[model samples]
Target: MPLYYYYFGVLNATLLFRTARWRPPLLSRHAARGCGHAPSYGKMAARALVQYVVLRGDLRREPLSWPLGALVAQACHAALAVTHAHYQHPDTAAYLDQGGSMRTVVLEAPDESALTTLAETLQQNSIDHKMWIEQPENIATCIVLRPYPKEEVHHHLKKFKLLK
Candidate 1:
């Protein structure tokens, strides 16, 4: 009667009540297999897949001042393009399978140079990503990485901050 088992039982009971379907036993699959301990909630959360989108902050600032809607469109374009390009990739497939639970982290790069440098670094590392260069104007506005395990790409992105 560990605390996690109690919480797990409560969660299973709630699921059963809501879905009206048979649920598995209170012991987790790992525990049932004789593992000494089940993964902690924090560990489970760390396993989640995520996508990272870096948009240029300068686009919305003075000098090159693009409209807010336009910046949003750039992010959308980059995200969709990368997802479509890597749709067949295993990580992308698994991430998409999460449906409503899918996670995306949107960060801000100071300007074109930072965005391009990041893209180049990713390229050198063989990381999969797409850099969206807006047509007609041919400006590189944003970059999106295919869904990846956070541990695999977080170091490269730690310098950037979440878009405000």
Candidate 2:
């Protein structure tokens, strides 16, 4: 009988009964026109927007040996910076509007040189991204691209493996 349970129960009942006639405001236009069920993964994947984060792997392995938390923070910093820079873009808006469905792929660049090269490629291709340079020390730590249709940017990133 907690307040949240009662409210959730009522909301669930409302949705269950009215699903065919009412759609949640957050659903995409295509979804709103369909049966209440979620879209199939294949269909979703075809148009899915994704943000890509590339972190420098060398920092975790050797000479630099940055702490795990610091690397994570670098990725976070780049992601937020680029998102803010592109907040007005349609893809970015839609990506943010997905709420819990937002997707991000974290990949690894072997070292600072690889990261810099990737950033240069992204820039040459007119892909917008933020490369985070850790302050004071001026070390380039990570790069995060704004949300884009997966197909549009995948080729530029296919060579990089996911950060394990």
Candidate 3:
């Protein structure tokens, strides 16, 4: 290809390498840096998922819910986690408990059939939910139910773009 394009590629690669090696400024002990973007509902939701996944280990094995005053980002995280469709595996039932006071649930499944079963079960429980698809280890889905009101999400989403 053109020499200019080759040099540009090399420069871009070098910058990425340097940034990856650089340390970010630490926030207060109580505050953590987010994904480096404005607090949109989608971004918040993404954060919640990462936190939930990291904290809970397995979404399928846990039933999660948040109080009304919980951070929207946390809600979004749980929402994104369940809707992702990976938490539907039958193995997930071990972590589920009927008496949990969750306003929402995150279901993850590894396959379409399992996801379908999960959706049906949630519907049967009279629980409100949403669906998300994720590729973790394998193609899977996570369904997040009883999400924060759509109004909250719409408000945040309006300020953000889904595509860069």
Per lDDT, the best of the predicted structures is 2
Which scores greater on lDDT, model 1 or model 2?
2
Off by over 4 Å in 2: 1-46
lDDT of 3: 0.35
Model 1 misplaced stretches (Cα beyond 4 Å): 1-46
> Per-residue lDDT tens digits of candidate 2, residues 1-164?
42222454444334343456544343455455563434444555578999999999999987888999999999998899999999767677667656568999999999999999999999999999999999999999999999999999999999999999
lDDT of each: 0.80, 0.83, 0.35
Score residue 49 of candidate 2 by CA lDDT. 91
Ten-residue stretch with the least lDDT total in model 2: 1-10
Tell me the TM-score of model 3.
0.24
TM-score of each: 0.73, 0.75, 0.24
Question: For candidate 3, lDDT tens digit of each residue in 1-164?
Answer: 32222354433233442454422222111124332322333443433321121111133232433233332343465555554443332212211211122233222233346555655765775544554433353423344453343443333223222211
